[model samples]
Target: MKVVPLGDKLVVKRLESAEKTAGGILLPDAAREQPQQGRVLSVGDGLMLPDGTRAPHEVNEGDRVVFSSYSGAEVTIDEEKLLILNADDILAIVR
Candidate 1:
């Protein structure tokens, strides 16, 4: 399934959390924390402006990004989990 975000909205695929700790201790699924980082799967055209123009987005497809912890809505498409969030919610792009 393909997803297209509209009006500054972004479609992100959350990166997988680490399975083991720094000490080499394996962590269970229940003990793992939800990752706030993800890859830019799909990007919206831009934010709709009142004057009738769309604002450009800084993030692009294939760019890894970090977003707010509590931002974005989680959705499941074709058994794959994804997140839809505003461009403003993105903190930084991973190098």
Candidate 2:
């Protein structure tokens, strides 16, 4: 399905959590923390500037990003989980 975010919003697909820790110990579902990393699926048009020129967002499609744990609204699209958040909610772009 095609998704288009409006007004500086971003659509991201959450990455799956690791099944085990660095020590190779299995982690229970309830013990796992919410994922803060995701792949950018869509980005909205640039935000309006005071001078009337739109300032484009730094993020783009396919960019891997990290966000606040509580950021964005969780949504399910076509049975696939996705997040919808404002661009300001994204903390950083992963290398």
Candidate 3:
């Protein structure tokens, strides 16, 4: 199924988190933290302003971004986990 976010929302898919420590010690799933980084999948047009003008988004689809730990709402789409976040919730775009 195809997903198209609406009204300043973004559809993002989380990237894989590290499975090993810096010292090469492998960590089990129970010991791993939820990933805060994700790739932009779909984006809304823009936010509506009081003047009825739409603000352009800074990020685009395919951009890798970082968000707060509890930023977005999680959902399962097409049997894959995805996140829906507001544009303001996205902290940074990874270069």
Candidate 4:
């Protein structure tokens, strides 16, 4: 399925969290925290400007990105979980 975000929204695929601690201690699923990082699946065309020029996004598809923990709306597409967030909610583009 193809999803195209409108306006300044972005579509992201969440990265799986670690199943163990740094010391190799196994952690239960319930103890795992939601990851704030994800891969950009799709980006909106860009925000419209007053002068009719669109502001391009710095991130592109397949780019690793970090966003606010509370940002985005959870959605399921083709039985796969994904996130839809605004561009402003993105914190940084991981290198």
Q: TM per model?
A: 0.97, 0.91, 0.94, 0.95
Candidate 2 residues 50-89, lDDT tens each? 8988789999899999999998999998999999999999
Off by over 4 Å in 3: none
Candidate 3 RMSD computed on C-alpha atoms after optimal superposition onto the true structure: 0.9
The residue pairs that clash in candidate 4, if any, are none
- Give lDDT: candidate 2, residue 28: 99
Model number with the top TM-score: 1
- Per-residue lDDT tens digits for candidate 4, residues 1-95, read 89999988999999999999999999899999999999999999899999998899989999999999989999999999999999999999999
lDDT at 37, model 3: 97
Global lDDT of each candidate: 0.96, 0.92, 0.95, 0.95
Q: Score residue 94 of candidate 1 by CA lDDT.
A: 96
Pairs clashing within candidate 1: none
Q: What ranges in model 1 sit over 4 Å off?
A: none
Residue-level lDDT tens digits of model 1 in 1-95: 78999989999999999999999999999999999999999999998889999999999999999999999999999999999999999999999
Give lDDT for model 1.
0.96
RMSD of each: 0.7, 1.2, 0.9, 0.9
Candidate 3's residue-wise lDDT over 1-95, tens digit each? 86899999999999998999999999999999999999999999899999998999999999999999999899998899999999999999999
Report clashes for each candidate as comma-separated counts: 0, 0, 0, 0
Worst 10 residues of 1 by lDDT: 40-49
